[model samples]
Target: MRYDDDPWQVAIWTSTDGTAWELVPDLDSFGRAGLRDIASSDEGLMVAIGYEVLPPEEGSQDPFTQAGKIWRSENGIDWIAVEGIAGQFGDVAYRQGEWVVVGAIDGRAVIHTSADLVNWSTAMLDGLESALGESKAPCPLTGRQRRNGRSLAGWPISAPPSSAPQLAWRSASGAGMHWVGQVDWAE
Candidate 1:
C-alpha cells in the first residue's frame, strides 16, 4: 500500500505473481482517511496506521495537531481501527513471535509491541530522548533482525545528534550497538 499523489487518496495494488500488479479499488470504505504505514503478520493479520487531525484551540500557534490510530484487517479487504494507540506510527514489522511498531509521540520516539496484534504495549525509546525538543516530525523506523538472534531498528536521527541516520541493534545477551551513526546508503 502506497500513495503516489493525488487528490491525496490512498490506493492498494495487488500482485498475484510478483511480476504483474493490479489496482484494488473501493478502499475509501476502509475509513483510513490517511494512512502512514502498514504491516502484516504470519498469522494472517494486517494492520495500517491512520490519523485524524484536531485543530489547535484558539490562540495556539501549533499548526500540526493530529491524533494517530491503528487499523486492523483480517483479509486486507475489511478493516477496523484498533483502540488505545495514541500517536502516529510510521512503520511496523513482525519478528520472533512479536509485532513491533515504531513512530513518535509528543515528538519523542515510541515503540509498541504486540504478540496477538490485537493488544499492544507502548514504550519510549530512551535513546531518543535527546530528540524530544529538537525533532518534531515522526522518524520513520525500519526494523531489521539478523539470523544470529540480533535485532536492529534504524531511523533518521535529528538535531542535537548530527542529523544522520543511525542503527541500534541488540544481541541475545542484551548488549549491542546503541548507535551506529552516519550510515552512507549510496555505498
Candidate 2:
C-alpha cells in the first residue's frame, strides 16, 4: 500500500501468516509525499504514483497541476523518479517486470505500461475488464475509495469531482499487488 504527500511515498508489508503483519520501511526510503499505491515487478522493482496536494501556482488561482511522476526503487528502498508521465496521475503497480500506472484519460481512468518506471505508454484496455468503468483503472489505495461509487468514463477532463478511480493492477493471486482481489474507487 501507499499514501499521499509532496514528492510521494510508499510502504510495503509482510507476514509469516496472514494473522500478523509488519510494516516494511526504515530501509531504502523516499522523502515523504502523498503516495497513492505500491507495486512490485518480478524483476525486483518497486513503483509508487500520486499527485501533490499542495500550494497553488505563484501567480495563478491554481498551480498548474503537476503531471504525475513515477518513482522506482530496487529492494523497496532508495528511490528514483521516472520523468514525463503527463497530467496528474492517480495510481501504479508493477507486474512481472513491467510497471503499469492508472491515470485519468479525458477525466476517466486509463492504463499505462512501463518496462522501466521511467517511461510509460497508455495501454488500450481491449475488452479489458475493470471492476468499475471500462477504462477507469484506478484502485483507490485507501479506505476513502471504499466509500465512493461508480462514475462515467471520460467525463471529468476539465473539472474536479468528489471521487476518482483508484489505481490498481493484476498481480500474483496469493501475494503482492494481486493479493487484494480487485480494487476499485467507483464500483
Candidate 3:
C-alpha cells in the first residue's frame, strides 16, 4: 500500500502469525500507484487492486485521470502487475471459481468478472441507480468473501437516510448479485 504523503513507493508485507510481520523488498517498481485491497483464493492465488493516476496535460486546468491497476501473486512474495479493465478498481473477491472486482467508471458502478484473472468481462450495474438514485454515484466499493464462500460488495451512501447503508450480495453458488438491500446492523 502507498501512503498519501509517499506516492512513489508501494510496500508489500507478509505475516504468518497475526502478531509478526515482514516487509517484502524491491517493490519500488510499482511507482505512483496505490493498492486499495487484496484477496487470496483457496487455491493460494492472490490479487491486489488499485489505480494509477495520469497527470493532466501541461498548463491545463483539467483534473488528472486514473486507470485501474491489478497485481497477482501465487506466494504473496513476488508480485506481477497485470493489465486491468477500464474502471478504477477498489476491491476484489474470489469464490466459487470466479474472481469479482468492484469499481466505478463515469460515475456508475461496474463489476468485472474473470475465471482466470487474465481475461475479464465488464458489466455496468444498472441496479445501483435504483438504490442510489440517478444523481449520486456509489462510493468506492468494498468486497468480502464470507467463511461460507458467499461474496458481498457494498458502498456506504451518505444521502438523506444515512443510517441505512446499502449492500449487494451473491451466493456461494456464483449467482448474480442481488443489489438492493439494507444492512441490518442489529444482526
List per-prediction Cα lDDT, in the order shown.
Answer: 0.64, 0.49, 0.71
TM-score, predicted candidate 3 vs. hidden true structure: 0.77
Window of ten residues with lowest summed lDDT in model 3: 1-10
**Residue-wise lDDT of candidate 3 within 1-187, one digit each (tens)?**
2133455567778888888998988775566776888888989999888877567667766565456788888877667888746777878888768888888877677778888987888767666666565655433555554633446676765555667667666556766767646665444
Worst 10 residues of 2 by lDDT: 150-159
lDDT of 1 by residue, 156-178 (tens): 55544565556554333434335
Weakest ten-residue segment in model 1 by summed lDDT:
1-10
| Candidate 2 residue spans exceeding 4 A from truth | 1-16, 27-29, 59-67, 105-108, 123-187
Better of 2 and 3 by TM-score: 3
Task: Please list the residue runs of candidate 3 whose C-alpha ends up more than 4 Å from where it truly belongs after superposition.
Answer: 1-7, 61-65, 127-139, 145-150, 158-162, 184-187
Model 2 Cα shift for residue 186 (angstroms): 22
Provide the lDDT at 55 for model 3. Answer: 74
